[model samples]
Target: QGRGRRRRRVAPLAVSPPPASERGEEPLLRGIFEIGKRSCDVVLSARRLRWSPIVPESPAGGTGREEIIEMKDVFSVKLKRRRFVGQKKGGTLLGITIFKCLHKEENKLTDCAVHLNNLSEDHCNSWFRHLKEILNGFQNRPKSLKVFVNPSSHKREATHVYYEKVAPLFKLADIKTDIIRIFIDFVFCVGGDGSVSEVAHGLLLKAQIDAGKGTDYIPAPVRASVPLGVIPAGEAKQYCYILSVICFKSLWHIL
Candidate 1:
């Protein structure tokens, strides 16, 4: 007893809530789930998902601590379940798993996951359907992307970077990707200046061809149907860095 010391329990930190207008009128669904090893009261709204830890009532009442995740940050949701060894048939329902994009240093975005563990299959399925519908309603999100990787860029590390770091996130988000197909909801490139230039040129060329014109078409080349995104893996990353700054600045203003 003389050498041992008692550990003090720290109060949970409270996070600021989203604006009322952003959350809309009412929650789409409400349920009890285990999050972060704590039993939480979860609420899913049109624009965000919120959760608060459940604690016994004290004389001081609640601490008003809650966590909120904006729907715009969420990329995918999947039903969680448990399957025993060699059990391919229907598994026991666990709950729902949400994959979201988290902002990190140097204008980077990475995947983060939150698991809502509940054993009730019916309850979980209801929440899953609502979450899926909400996600599908985001028309700005692309379902498929055409990827172009320059294996020669940066000592031939571009391919490795794309496969190792980028492809897993895309797969987790349930996005379909094709390297050589013409049909695409978006265009993604991983390389340096040369690769970026080639992809841009090729998109414009394809647009012109789709408009029944050739490469020499001068009267304002048709615009590409999908947008292009770049991942800098080459020596010349200054342009990409600058673009990221501008984009984040705009987002900051919007927020």
Candidate 2:
């Protein structure tokens, strides 16, 4: 018999475990609930909500699939109910509804709701209060917003876009909003360069006036009291260089 060639031996690659925050954190609450049509075992941690389908006992004993949603993405939580038309006094408690922002393709975000169905009102109420407290603890997220949309921008599609896409998400998130004719200290504009410049200029002028400085012969303009956010809804070809620089800075800040 010919001698077999020596087989090369390779060690298995080591896979790192998830971080302590993700893997080792203790759950705040655990319960049994129906998600969609399947019964599931649900768990809530400080930073995540997890649900796993409850599998029946089997000789082969396998783990059911688990789904997780980050708490940061959750915006609102409410007690779900079922009521007949014109019967608003009290409705049957169905379960809990959680509204969250879900990441979609191409870096877009969509509002979504998850219903945890349970017959017991007390159980749902406990979960609802815990979720509400968790949501309220996110201080970085805004509770209310003042929105100003330029109706003439993007072939007059800006208003439609706001109402159809943006407003719905805000509403679902339970974020109080003022669709301003004009409002707020920290203003934002949803239009092209002209709209941005107009808003920025007005803020600067207001800053100068507040500081008792004359507009005609101002050596140094006062800094704007509040920040301005720009949402590009129109083309800015001529100002592309400046916008790109600003965008780069914004991205840097975000990162």
Candidate 3:
């Protein structure tokens, strides 16, 4: 009958459920998370932190995980719960600060931040807890860095400067750059007389240590003097002076 036909159509609609979301107990935290300086739509799900182009990389904001920052790859996350308050400037500000050392892409490491904004407290906190727990699992993560500190430089705090100013950028870039005394190649220097001497002396000291351990550092193919390149950043340049005078040519000038 006519009543039976109405029931069949109604049944199909009921079976469809909510096609968009899967009975979300809470809403998903999805917004733009800045791919470069430009804003893009990012989704924070239970599994992964994913982003897709809102600026139209293809049709209809594309689809699927075109760019994804896996939860496992996330290293350090600093959650910011501050909102710039005032009548002039007021919003429910939530930020998920991600300092990530991403998994290797083409056998290379990448580090970056997933900067997010305009999220509810529930969404932010949920993502925070999830992210924190995942990051905790990586406490025993392996790391490598090569740190060169000029002790007698102008500020006499080159190491401190590296720790403060430079290291944060390295962390953001997902680049490992903070282990001490770890260069086997030509040790390049760019400070005053102390710097040049320190590097040259350090290499010899390292060589001496290696030699004492019965390890021949100067192997068959690699010669005694490895090439060192320096682009000077200071006024007093003893390394460059020595190189130019002796025809060693530490600095390369392009014609």
Task: Please give the distance, in angstroms, between residue 61's alpha carbon in candidate 1 and its true position after superposition.
Answer: 8.0
RMSD of each: 20.4, 16.6, 17.1
What TM-score would each prediction reach against the true structure?
A: 0.59, 0.60, 0.38
Tell me how far the alpha carbon of residue 21 in candidate 2 is from the true structure, in angstroms, after superposition.
2.9
Better of 2 and 3 by lDDT: 2
Q: For candidate 2, lDDT tens digit of each residue in 163-206? A: 99889778777899998543244465667788878888888887
Ranking by lDDT: 1, 2, 3
In candidate 2 the C-alpha lDDT for residue 240 amounts to 33
What is candidate 1's TM-score against the reference? 0.59
Greater-TM-score candidate between 1 and 3 = 1
Q: On residues 158-231, what C-alpha lDDT tens digit does candidate 1 reach at each position? A: 67888899888888778998864233455677777788778878888866766677786457777876567777
lDDT of 3 by residue, 1-255 (tens): 566565434445445565454442232465555555556677665447777656566666564446766666666776655555554454455666877675578787857666765356776677678666656556466555677775533234556777787788667535577566333444456666566666666555544543343344443322224445454555777665666543245444211
Instruction: In model 1, state the lDDT of residue 244.
Output: 68
Which candidate tops lDDT?
1
